[model samples]
Target: MYGINSLIKSGSLEAAYPLHSGTYKWTVSGPLSDRQIYYKICLKITNYEMPRTEMEFDSSYIYKCYILDCINHFGSLMFFGFIMGRALDHPGVVISNPVSEAFYRNCAGLSCTFEMAVLQLTIWFVRSCFKMFTKLIIPYLNVKKRQKQHDSKFPNQKLRQWESDYLLNKSERYRIAHEYLDTVAEYGYVTFFISSFPLAPLCGFLTNIMHLRIDAYKSITLYRRPNAKKVPKLICFTKLLQATTYFGILTNAAMIAFNSDLVPKEIYRMYYNASLEGISHQQFSKIPTSTVYSFYKYKANEETCYYNQIRDDNQNKTLLYWWILAIRFAVLLGIEHIVFLVQGFVAYMIPDVPYSVQEQIAHQKKIQSDRRETEFSFNINRKKSVRETERFVLIK
Candidate 1:
């Protein structure tokens, strides 16, 4: 959603320095090493040092700067979440755990409870920002219609002078750019908090399971000398959980990245121009949402084509279309499922199994006690019968 200029202005390390082909050079200080240049940028954080080798020199200072920049960004964002988490009650969001008692009581803890609350507040803020940007500031941007310049050097077609100049002004352009970035940041934060809804229960379950496993292992080691060498099968279950979580995070990140990039430059231009010109709300509403979906679908189809590269000649086209549709459907279904889970349908369906398991075990114990009572009564009756028989025989 942001251009190179926007990122640089926003203090992103990745965009801090000018790119000369494949290499990045930084003459400035703060998270850099080796005055000398290197072949590849090795992103790291270290104190500045004079370059001893050409490789170290080639690595450049930009990489380390990028790392520090990202760390700072995340730190600031987390802090923002902490502060905002206290304000609202996100209906579907969950907070699973608090690292400290203070955090638990603070109302803005990073746990599911607090995070969800913050998410709701963030959403409200985003909506307000969007309204202010679109309804108020956007009209102001279109006010001064500067005559846009069309360079004669690459002119095959006529270009509007005002349109060209509007986009070139550093301040105007940055405003347009930053608005886009800010929207992304705000919405991303809200969605992130909302999505964390599942994390609390999952964490609690895993924590309890880990405690049980640890206790069981300790007991086995102290008392049962046998089967010490055999590893627990449940360890594999933990690994599976880790794998699924990692994969899901990766996929989600990719999707968000792709969607953000797919945003049309024309839309940005339209919003900026409309804001300045006082475009009618009715006309603005006519802007097509389908365009966004079309672009997304186009790129997604390209991926489907790549997957269909080795398919049979007869079914490739048909298969590709079907595959794309299936993928779209699957995505929709997954999203709906997530919504349902957030609304407590799925969570209610799988109400804490450990509690049920404990109840079942307790019930089994009661049944066993009743069986024992019945057996004891039967044995006492048999003993009396035997005594009576023996006494009768003595009399005879």
Candidate 2:
């Protein structure tokens, strides 16, 4: 009954986390004593008469949160790009400036800004990679645990679908990690080669650095992810690996801060969750406790129950890691456009700095200097002739 309860509770937590964050109540199938429910209730009970040690929110949920973030950040930035492009050609903004030079200069600035944005995008990519790698480790651990449990149940062995799925998910993660590495290389190389555009040359270098930073995170995943199932030890030595990765990320962040000039502030916000830090623990505690209470309360009624006893497509749909890469690209593009808009507005507010415009401005300055020098010489010659004539008259 406890094992059944645990299964039901796990399923309930999985279902609820993606949906809501607050108080919810439901009923269970079995006729259980209030004592059982008292033992089972894992959620926060503001009413002290019904005491419950709130189960900590699963840290694992962070994987999903990160994925959603990746989606929102990049997807919005992509739309912003289209707006910036359209705004550049608008009659009001286009007509006010020296048309051709202004156009090229603005476009060039846009290119530079984008090159800087790659750093933020790269950090996101790495974070996703780390998350996926951890997922793979988890499934592998699950498979092992399942294997030990299975041998006791049946002497003759046939592998189950869950085992197969775990293996498949594991293989997929490895393949995806390699793909990310390949992409990092490709983007890095191409960014290095392009030099004709204003910011093209910096693109390759910045991208390479981004890839290296992300790749470094794999070490952390290898350490932390392997131990997801092992929570008993006083200090999981494996966690030290995660700590190392954290340090690596901090180091990378610092390097980007000082060494790389291409990072944009908006893009950086996407990587770290400012609102999450304080709220994270409270958020983490609710899921498991809530799951135990809710699943037990609703187990008997199939119509009301959100999860099935057996794994099905609905039960197994938390594959956000698979789609994370595409989502990040979309979000990064949106962030880029927003940054560009802010920058353009700020530049418009401040007085234009000297020689920041096109080469034509420098040429015009040179012509004006030449004209003034020529006029000064002509005036000096006229005064000299008048003085010479006056001397000649006095002598006569």
Which stretches of model 2 miss by more than 4 angstroms?
Answer: 1-83, 88-135, 151-396
Model 1: how far residue 374 lies from native, Å: 96
Candidate 1 lDDT by residue in tens digits, 41-149: 2322222455676434323343343233333323333433343233222111233453322222222111223344343344344444444555344444543333213
- lDDT by candidate, in order shown: 0.36, 0.36
How far is 308's C-alpha from truth in model 1 (Å)? 56
1-396 in candidate 2: lDDT tens per residue? 112234345553233111112111111111111312322232223233332432123222222222332233333222222222322321112233444432322221222224324433443344445545544456556656755666668658776754434333233222332344334333332332122123433544665575566545534332223323334542222333333333333323332332222332233235555333332221112212332322123344334323212123323323332333244444445544554566579768875554566467888899999999999999999899999999999999
Each model's total of backbone clashes = 23, 24
- Model 2 weakest 10-residue run by lDDT: 23-32
